[model samples]
Target: MKFQVRCFNIILLVLLLILIYFFFYHLRYIDDDGEPIGTVYITETRGRLDKSILTDYVKDKEDEYFSAANISVPILVWWTPFTYDTGSYTRCNNNNQARCFISNIRKYRDNKQFSAFLFYGTSFRLYDLPLPRHDHEQWSLIHEESPKNNYAFSFESIMNMFNHTATFKRHSDLPLTTQWLASIDDLLDQTYLIDVKEKTQLQTTENLAPIIYIQSDCSTPSDRDLYVKELMKYIQVDSYGGCLHNKDLPENLRNPVETMEHDEILKLVSKYKFTLAFENAICTDYITEKFWRPLKVGTVPIVYGSDQFQDFLPDNHSAISMLDFTTPELLARFIHELNVNDTMYDSYRHFKLYQIISNDTLLARTMSERKWGIHNDRVRGNFIHQFECLVCERIHKTRQDPTIKYQAKFDDYGCPPPTTFDKNGEKLERSGNWYRSYEFTRCQLEVFHELLDQKNYSFTEKDINNAATKRFAPSFRRNEFLR
Candidate 1:
């Protein structure tokens, strides 16, 4: 009887072990999304994203499983920076899910050992030797300034995060550079819109001053100071901050430009009719917050630097272009007229009524000549959050299939040479009209008229006479201009 009881207990134990094995196997191999399940081992040579941040990102994104029958489980494996020994794969080998390794070519010379390798652009230099494309799949990722920082890697695929069209190539034969473009054109989309009744109250508030310019960068490649100085001669531009401090800023607002809070700066700017929005460098599609801020605060932006200003603007009347007028005097005259005429000035504010569009839609429309539907599905957050999330998603997709390959050549993805100038400081034409093309001017006017017609704003002679009664305030005018 004792021998029979002992045999029964051993059989029960064996059955329990079999049940545990089947449970894990079924969970791993289950097909929910029709995608494969596999682990993506990412080992960074130079640390970019913090380990904690990467861990959190992966955990959040783990819901997206890999699609393949062989890949039963999807996992993201990362090596602790500085803690792991680079020469040995003992740590990686221990994990069954460790499929690929991303490391610097210079640091890790043994390319044949790893299943995959990823080369980061910021750390890459032209002098660095080419990474050998052995059995492993090789990929390049770049988000740095191009042309100046060129790479000679014969990558199977390249991922670019720049503000130009994906097909825009400096050289014809250059390989494909995929677009992961970044821009602040979605600022208005993120803002909560006021009701139609409340919008009238917001619009009725008068702009007390003519123009305001707050800049700390006195020296720049574009030499924006010369243009500002010339415009000041004709119009009363209240110069604040370190660049040109003609007027005393409030005691609370006397801090360094960088340290100043966004709300405080916007409060000061909202009092003015116009704001000088000039960029430091004149690069293609390289617009910054200097252009966006004024539009957000209901002030007309007198934009400079970017020749393709229309691309960024909601419409032609959204902002006054420095390139539109031949000289500073002409631009100043236009601003002065707008300041004196209330009806004309109010016309510029028509963009507030229309829904703000995203940069993606704008680019699509410009490239395809057809009106692309507004991008309502854009991820709303800070640039870093959106950018890192995209990178993580792409990495997962690439790791799922080792057969995927992309070609990104140096000349095609590189930045064009800086604009050449003549002896008189005038921009010289190289291949075509570099400044403002005729097509751009025509498009700007057409967009302005279209928006104007939508609003149905027609000013009669009587309306103009009534608007003339309310002139700009004396305090807002410069002491010399008032005299």
Candidate 2:
């Protein structure tokens, strides 16, 4: 009886040892709920809070896709100066001691487990600190809103947060690119086309006496002052802003910066037949609110910035392009004709029928269709939220594929200087004397002679093109393209 009892005790001891081994194995390799785990560390930089908010947002997004069978969740931890000492900060249940561990940035720098390093373009100067050596498996995040020439980074991919599409520059050599442009979704919802149509019909019937221009910038690289002055000759233009102050607005509306924010500006614009929508500087795909506001208010926008303005319009007739005419006089004449002819004017408002879609919808459709390779469509979005979501998604994708790598040469992509095109849709050389050098092309000379004929001023095209350099008063330069 004593021998049998000792044998039973030994058998129980063996079973206890087996249980101990299995428990330790599971503790080391498995997460809560016995699922395998992966972790990604985001750096704590100037935009750390925004990044954290985005991380939580992505978590909420993931929860929407969660399933009962698959409880896998990627651990997103913050890597700050404190993280270097205490490791990473992760939430832990009071009962699960084995599942919690402090993560350190220094340890992770040498360890290949960290997923990505997000670098904001504006904070590029802070990169002197120690960071992980360039790793093929990890992602390097860089985003820029403007081509400010101050950006410095060695990135594998780029997120362009400009107000234009990723294909705005059309550089084939650019690295893997993502776009996060300005979102007009909220703005579109606030605007009502029904009221705009009513206002437009009333104005057409009443025949407003003067066109309106609200400009504040007295100086600009785009020669807007000269163009506006020349346009004023063919028709009366009531200048409201500081550039050519013929009329003073109320004290509350005197500041362009403040007035532009409210709908009061659009309200004032709706009373007019046309509004000048000229950009301060001509950049590829750099259309801003100046162009969009007039359209929202049912006033025809005389646009003069991006050569690709037609692409953003709901229809070709939605806005008039400054490039369509050879001279400002011709454009002015066209606007006059449209103002007098109500039917012709009403045709421009046809786009009011279709409601504008959010930037998110446009982007998803563009990506699904793989249409980023072409400039066929306008791309805009809620720049902040969409950009953060995109970054998070890319990081998750890289975690799944450890072999992924990207490296783009900086010279392969850039914002080149804007190109000048004549009315015939041909590029022109920037260098040469203005009216006096006969450097103008045959097409330009023909347009010049036609303008002169309209004014009943006879001048041989060859003589005018090759006329000697002559100085004119600043006012004359503003009121006339050539004198």
**TM-score winner:** 2
Off by over 4 Å in 1: 1-209, 248-261, 353-404, 409-416, 419-483
Estimated TM-score for each candidate: 0.49, 0.50
Consecutive 10-residue window with the lowest summed lDDT within model 1: 171-180
- The number of clashing residue pairs in each candidate reads 7, 4
Q: Considering every candidate listed, which one attains the maximal lDDT? A: 2
Error in Å for residue 399 of model 1: 6.4
Candidate 1 residue-wise lDDT, 1-483, digit = tens: 999999999999999999998776444433334332332223312234344533443354333221121222222111123212112111121334442322221223222223323333444432231322333333333332332222221121222311111222322121111121223343343243233233233334632347788887775545567667777777777888678778767777776444333567766666677788886646445455677676766677888755665665656567887777767778878987887676677666566546444435454344243211122223332222222233334444556775654444543343333342333323433212222222222233333334344653453434433333222223223323211
Stretches off by above 4 angstroms in model 2 are 1-133, 136-210, 353-382, 406-413, 418-483
| C-alpha lDDT score of every prediction, in listed order | 0.45, 0.47
lDDT of 2: 0.47
